[model samples]
Target chain A: MRRMAAIIGCGAVQVGKYPDRLESELALDAVRMALLDAGIEKGQAEGIFTTPDLRGGIGLQANLLCEYLRITPKSMAEMTCGAVAAGLTVKTAVNEIMLGQIDVAVCYGAERECSIEWFKHFGSALFEPVALQPYASYGIIWAYAMSARRYMHETGAKEEHFAMAAVRNRRNARHSPVAAFKAPIAIEDVLESRNLCSPIKLLDSSASLDGAAAVVVASAEFARRVCPKPVYIMGWGQYHDNSCIIPTDRCDKSISSFVATREAAAAAFRVAGINPEDVDVAEVYAPFSPHELIIPEDIGWFEKGEMVKAIETGETEIGGKIPVNTDGGLLSRGHPWAVTPFYQTINVVRQLRGEAGENQVPDARIGLVHCEGGMMNNVFVLILGSE
Target chain B: MSKVDFAWPASRHTPSGREFWAGLKKRKLLANKCQLCGEMFFPPRLCCPACLGDRLEWFELSGKGTLYSWTEVFFAGPEFKTPFLLGLVDLAEGVGRIASRIAGAEAGELKIGMPVRFTFVDAGEDFTIYCVTPDTG
Candidate 1:
């Protein structure tokens, strides 16, 4: 029988510009908070998983974080899978604990992209050197914009649908004290915002900020002994398509539908033994507004070309059928790249714990967290339940 | 705030990719075809991504394809001009889609599934780049 793992505690620093602090400082603050929340001492963490500071190009990030926290971990690793890295780190910690490799593990990520000098240039560092770069200036926004255009063309989802997503997330952010953009925005505000790319206005994109988020995973025995309430990791899944550039090789048929997300969600649901309707809340990783519309359908929350109607009918808002991104997703919470997904997982934990003060969903028993990395190349899905 | 200065040196290419770049200088688009699976690949690869076969042949592309998707990028890197149209074109030969700059047309006029043809442009210092334009003819 496989040992089960659960999230015992979570923490995060405010998501905004922190130019005065280094990436390590932000990570240290979040880690300390997480330890406090778990009611466990820093010395209790036997394993450490850290997200690589790509924006800062810092070497030996895992070691540096361990040294700063005074954590003499038995095992450590640095994950570098872009936005989904944090989710992957959590999964790694869970596996380590389940295998009896460690009793408790701390997974944390931090980013100072707002303070980094080459923030814009860091976008294309992952593309194929000679081929992809020469054709078009490869950047995350350009790739997502192309996907958005195709999604709109296929689903009859106008730019307004994307605007509705922006407006919805910003509205949710109003209740989130840690969200970067809290002011409520209208559809007109999103539409009138300067165009970063056609069909993807400036408002449709998430802001790049400095932030850090951390989570503590414990073995079932450890949780039972110390933690009063633990959110069990009912199921987890990860998938990768390995396509570096956008308009993936499967673009002919699967442009709007992300195969990785579907496969990952399927695996997770099977392990959780729960259907899509059983999920009470979701915190999906959608850095762009169009993605917020498409990810729900890809993850089996909605049917083909039906997300527009769901959004229009207010089924995805707080108190709706499937309140998504209640803690102001990346759209309003500010995307700090690798560190952002931890915020998503943390939100799910809070919802399950009934600790979400203002953004709490009524009686949210089961919650789902989804994240994508590298032009939708990698996807991680986790299902958590209050048992 | 003090400005941070950085420079990225030219990229190094593998043997297969070197040939692909050499073909571009002569205005030819090249792809790799797997001998075992017969699958094609763009941005030329040494091994077949599908079958993991090492025996691959260099195949010149027809330079004609259909627009799979497109975007008008108003912001981009320093090397690229602002407000440019970038497209993902599905090669007619069934190799794969490639990202290319769309020229000789307005961004608004471009449509999905429109036929397009590849053209080569010189980027100075012996660097050649590929672009696509609507096959209006």
Candidate 2:
């Protein structure tokens, strides 16, 4: 008797800074293809959610997109939570559909990070735009460096432990066409790369590239009639942790991510009436490799400090007991902030339907997707299944 | 002192940094406080999102505050030069504040938890802003 939500169609456009100034074109094109993929008419969607492109002006982006596409939604919202915003949008739309607010919903994101000129154009707004001009990029680097430093101090995890994750993810990326950095890397390579921030090198971070992704979500009855293969949203959770960036009286060892993920996992499992063991695949947002350790431990996949052992033993790989980030993850797949999480959900939807060709898990009936945003600002987890 | 030049957008809300500069004239920092939730909004908000509080109270904050966390930037912005320190200052009224360029220090002497006061500098082109050491420090 549980209501099901399904992603009927998905599309991605890789403009790749080719024309140097075609973000609007790329965004509009992605929207068209997504509607086509879902087999839904362009004008039928009732809700539209967008993740703001760093290149576009704040309020202008959403309305501009609506105008360009020539499709208007009864309700529209812009998601600013960076990478996880897309999946979160889907969750929001699904809730609204269940609540009888809308029928079909569209979520998408686009950016041109490869062009330095575009960044400088927008860099004028910041009062202090030197050294670390885009302050948000520093969040990932700092989070990793700080976490790695603390892990090293407490659990004896070396730089190599973190480096190995990059190697594995890059290896996974080799199989993916849209991945930003498919080229394999070594421990020495990571150590030698230019430091964006201390303890996090160039190789540890995802590339800032131009691309777009979109998905369509609808209610159970609508999905059953309109779509051939509908993946049920078995469980989902989102959490916000507003705390001091630097731990003052709070425990530094315990991050806001743990607090958020634990709550999300509990809610998701309750909704699905399942446990951790029931999950077959996991796609988590790890822009930095060190998070490969912290997230799994937080979700109880492994004991504290055991993620390194899990990675080293190949237990978290494609053929492992529980494959993770089979879609190359944000580190390899390129983190577009808003688009990345939907990519995670799309990967799950494909795997559940047995449509994932080379990287698919054979009998993955249940899949888990996790996205952490805004310096651990929010944690959103979704559990999907075929039944 | 040597001369410096900077570029900025002419915005009506605070056309060319005038919004922040004008507040310092009365020795007051203007912020939008959410009337419903009782939380102060920094950089001024059009509305309070938590409670859908449309009406915001524009109030002047007392310039007194305690230095939270800060870092000295060796590299500077176009409007700002090197040796500027950015700090998250907690006001006496229990709200967090973000400001740039702790002036009157030689970069090497910056410390966390140091007491500081706010100040303004007219860059002549637009408006240059900074925080300087307080008499209490």
Listed in order, each prediction's TM-score against the native is 0.93, 0.70
Candidate 2 TM-score, C-alpha based: 0.70
lDDT scores of the candidates, listed in order: 0.82, 0.65
- Tens-place lDDT per residue, model 2, A68-87, is 77878887888776456776
Each model's backbone clash number: 0, 2
- Deviation in Å, model 1, residue A73 alpha carbon: 2.2
Clash list (residue pairs), candidate 2? A82-A337, A83-A337
- The window of 10 residues in a row where model 2 chain A has the poorest summed lDDT is A129-138
Q: How far is candidate 2 from the true structure (C-alpha RMSD, Å)?
A: 7.0
Candidate 1, residue A216: Cα displacement in angstroms equals 1.3
Give the DockQ (C-alpha) for candidate 2.
0.07
lDDT of 1 by residue, B1-137 (tens): 01112223246445556778778779899888899999887766678888989999887989999998899988777766688888888889876777788888898789998999998777655667778999987
Q: How do the residues A1-387 of candidate 1 rate in per-residue lDDT, one tens digit apiece?
A: 122888898989989988689888898899999999999999999999988886545568778888787779997888877677788888889888877899899999888864234545554544453344544663567878888888988889999999998999998888885789998899999999999878888899988888898999999889878888788888988888767646445335466778788989998998999998899999999989999999999889899789988889988998988999997898899888778888988988898999888889999989999998766768999999886
